[model samples]
Target: MRQTLLATSLLGLSAIMPAYAADYVIDTEKAHAFIDFRIQHLGYSWMSGRFNDFSGTFSYDAEKPEASKVDVDIDVTSVDTNFAERDKHLRERFLETDKFPKASFKSTSFKQQDDGSLMVTGDFTLHGVTHELSFPVQKVGEGADPWGGYRAGFVGETEFTISDYGINVDMLGPSSQVVYLTLSIEGIKQ
Candidate 1:
């Protein structure tokens, strides 16, 4: 009878506790990040480019926003535009990825906004320059996957000028260009 009571108490405690703790680290294989940008092509038409290889991790708990944190890293040399010539020019001249291979972001805090979304304000580094950036983020949803891993998804977007990153513009023949970044990060809770 005593063994049965102890087992019951342990089961009750397990039920009350989360399957995974809030400190659960994010698994990057189940995540994604995309950067979208447009630049004028000799004042004719706009050219769009995107980077392909990027990685990030986040610890999120809806009940504990204060404990949430995120860190992201983007490979600047992975810039792609579907054109080899243009991509080559961008990596060699525009972004200078050889000198600055990776851009990163580390969040200072996460706040819940009026609309029930989240705002992550952090220092974003690009081209060896650091800039303050705040992005609006929404928790898409969380659920169990058929493969038996838990998943959480989020969406965030932010925009800034290319010149802010110290990139030369004479090649593009413009003083500045609007660079837009969109993040869709999905994490698998281990």
Candidate 2:
């Protein structure tokens, strides 16, 4: 009788334990994650730039998406717009890498759409200011990598006013306030 009572108590305890979610670490070495942005230049064409270094980690399960989370860190000094001179000016005048050398995003919630898409809402910090941002994310691909690590990829795009991040729109001289951003991330399972 004592053995049965102990077994029942153990099972009951296990059932009441809070469930934990599986997590994956960002493959900083081979993530191939890209953070690219574009802004209108001088009221004419757009100037595009990409950051070369960043890292992130996330937990996701298609069946249990509510438990998912994401955190990403980007290096501001790695911004590359192809033109060396402009890139320098961007880091110094606009981004001010010396003052704020890093930018980051951390997910707060996830809402699944009827169309099988996800709306991940999070806090995005840039230029030393934090703001709420949401992006529509879609599963791009998923499978095993050539290196034997399992992987999953996703794409998210959003546009926001650069001025909202405390950037000067006039110093750049009549540039558009809205900036287009896209993220392509491939995370490896840990």
Model 1: weakest 10-residue lDDT segment is 19-28
lDDT of 2 by residue, 49-125 (tens): 99899998988887677778999999999999999999999899888899999999999998898888789999999
Runs with alpha carbons beyond 4 Å of true place in candidate 1:
1-33, 39-46, 171-176
Candidate 1, residues 1-190, lDDT tens digits: the string is 9999999999999989864334334454543445566666766777877777777778888876656788888898988899999899888887898899999989998888999889899999999999999988998888887888788888888888878889756755652376767777777775
* Best candidate (score: lDDT): 2
Query: Model 1, residue 131: what's the lDDT?
Result: 94
- Where model 2 places Cα greater than 4 Å from the true spot, the runs are 1-20, 171-175
lDDT of 1: 0.79
**Whole-model lDDT, model 2:** 0.86
Clashes of 1: 0
